[model samples]
Target: MEISTKVQIVTKTTTYHPPLAISSFPSVPLITPFARPANCGGIYARDPGDILVIDEQPESSSCYPPGFATDESSFFSPGLACPSGYWSACMESTGVNTITTVTCCPIYRSDVSLSCVDPATLAGVWKSQFCTFIPARSVPVPVTRSSNGRTSTTTSTLVNPGGINAFGIRMVYQSSDVVTASSSSSSSSPSSSTAANLGPDSAGGSGLSTGGTIAIAVVIPVAVIAAIIGFFLLRKSRRARAAQPAALPAQIEENPHKPSPYYDYKPIFAAHQYHGGELPTNQASAELPASSESPVELPAEAQRHEMR
Candidate 1:
């Protein structure tokens, strides 16, 4: 069996701004690279109240102040300003010399209906005491495009106005889009018998791999346990050996005649019996001879008598 999938995405972008009152002027040829005229002719002044009305044209003989010049005329000055009716101004410097070029633009006033004046009419009415006539303001237009697989829209506007000499205005906008295709495989073929054989082989291979890992894990722990047991046994045996008494030298047997606490002793004598005036057969006896002389004489007399 086989399966497939697809995805789609979309995005949008929008931008808005307060409309600009004046357009950008064309580039002009001048000694200073940053010097340019305004998009329209209008009076520029240091003080807001000094801005004159555009009801009548001034004469051609009019001359500006010592340090001021018309919007179309090029002159050197340290600073510039927009009059009461003008709402914005900008100044840029080349840094080659200390001279700065100033440009000014008319305000988008709902209260007044003053149209842009011609350069000749402006020259005829030029006054140095009032403000100088400089260049107009530069405003950006929004552009939108949608083609191929992409779409984009951009809008811009000046946000902050600091002063005549500073570029304080900021521009901001937003954009968004889509992407689809991904790098992933789909499915497999429809061969049931082939898949069955392959499945067994794959399962066997996985089983073998798992078996090896399990064997290694079990064997390592068992070996460690055995080693620990053996170490304990060896230590116990050493302690037992240290606790046993040392072997003594050989001893000789003691003499039997010597007095000792283990044996007792007594004195021995022979037994004898006594008889009165007789000796044993192993003794010799002696005879007595008392009236010897008298007896012998008597016996001799008697024998003589008998013989007679």
Candidate 2:
């Protein structure tokens, strides 16, 4: 089912208003809004002519980001002013010894149009009214116990012999031209020698480097093994070289069963070569001296053969 309703349109006379004036601000008052004291979506603001106004306020969490914290750095330097859209805010941190005040941006409405004022500059502004500052508080010094297990409430002031200069570096001075320890009667040469010999360069070194030690340990054995192998090889070569000369004069042994090679050669006479006419026919024996090829002459051999 459809129900018909009447629609009405009304027109007003031409009214003069400043350029860029809001439809309901600095000129006309908006009708009763759903929320009380609401002129805009956020907190109370100021009008040009001392009239109460309202404008958009950023979320409280926006001030916690790192970007806003950097802009709020204006809190550190009193002379520095906040950037065009940023406003300085003070944050308090309670420490064990003291409370620290950190400056930060209160409203993080960077993308949107909003008003930001310095709390120091504006004494009675709405921005200052909403923001509160922490007062300076005094802190007591901590009590420390001595090594002897004794505790005391009293404190002692420490004096700095080497005072810091404008650059925050401690000033150093040469106490005396000569060392005081040298004047002592006792000899300190042994201790100085020990300190100097502690490391390759100086006693300040913790110890020899592990890599160098390991390299030395590995190289020494390898060098020893290589030396030992070289020594044995050289010894074997010398023995082999010595044996070559002795082997050069070696002679081949002659066969013992064969007749001596030093014997004189004589051809045996044939039966036709024997002269039977001069002697008895068919003479069977002709004796010769024994051992004709012997190196030494026989003392009294000349054995006679039997006649056939």
Candidate 3:
């Protein structure tokens, strides 16, 4: 009996659909008395040699483990602490499950992780419990889904359950760092170019403003000093002129001489000399005194009588 059995192959097919928008996911509270999972989406696994580092708590503290030192230095070595804007989520093994021992240390991923990362490139998936500080009520994380060879990405927020508003403590996955960095660089290129173009103008403007201010400061003082000196010199010149003595007018003397009435006075002197030549009887009459007064002149009648 040769019986041939027909063989059939069945393959499952899936239809691709984009992930729902990040806004669609309702807000969910974060789990508290927070415990670290054994595996977070198959990305991170707790190693046996891994040590849980936690912030030191005081005896009176209620949020953290007791008996730990109150200072943050007790948790890790220098430079191992988380950087600013980040907080640590230290985990410890409880024989059955891993739990968070402390969650308030400021440390980086390499400080807590036992595994080593490539220093040359920050590409690939890096899983850690450390989170960025979230001042808001919730923390947002990106989530991706792949269906029928199609992939999509969205974000979901983790809410605080303890009502004590603080940063969220959860596993965080960072993937495709290179792609993110490239996108950021491309977006920032235009702004950087514009700033570069405006740099020279801004520098020139500042230099011109400084030079103008210096010139004003120097010129104003020099002008003021010159004016003051000029004022002083002018005042001194006026004072000198006022102190000098004034000149007086010259005095004139009166003339004592008068014009003679006779046009020719030679005859009078000749006749007087002739009378004297006739041998005047009196010697005193012939000689005249040397006085400033003119000689006495006889009247016409007296002259007629003398002629007679």
* Candidate 1 residue-wise lDDT, 211-283, digit = tens: 2344579999999999999999999999899766432211113355544333444333212233576555554
* lDDT of all predictions: 0.29, 0.29, 0.30
lDDT of 2 by residue, 1-308 (tens): 99999999895543322111112112221111111121222222223322122221222323121112112222221111222122323333334222223222223122222222344554333332323222133322222323355534333221222110000000111111012212331243322111111121221222222223545799999999999999999999999999987742343234444433345333445454745557646767789868857498766778877999
TM-score of 1: 0.16
Off by over 4 Å in 2: 1-207, 252-308
- In candidate 3, position 257 carries an lDDT of 42
Looking at model 2, which ten-residue stretch has the lowest summed lDDT?
Answer: 163-172
**1 or 3, which is superior by lDDT?**
3
Clashes per candidate, residues 3 or more apart or on different chains: 7, 0, 4
- Return the top candidate by TM-score: 2
- Report how far off residue 78 is in candidate 3 (Å): 36
In terms of TM-score, which candidate is stronger, 1 or 2?
A: 2
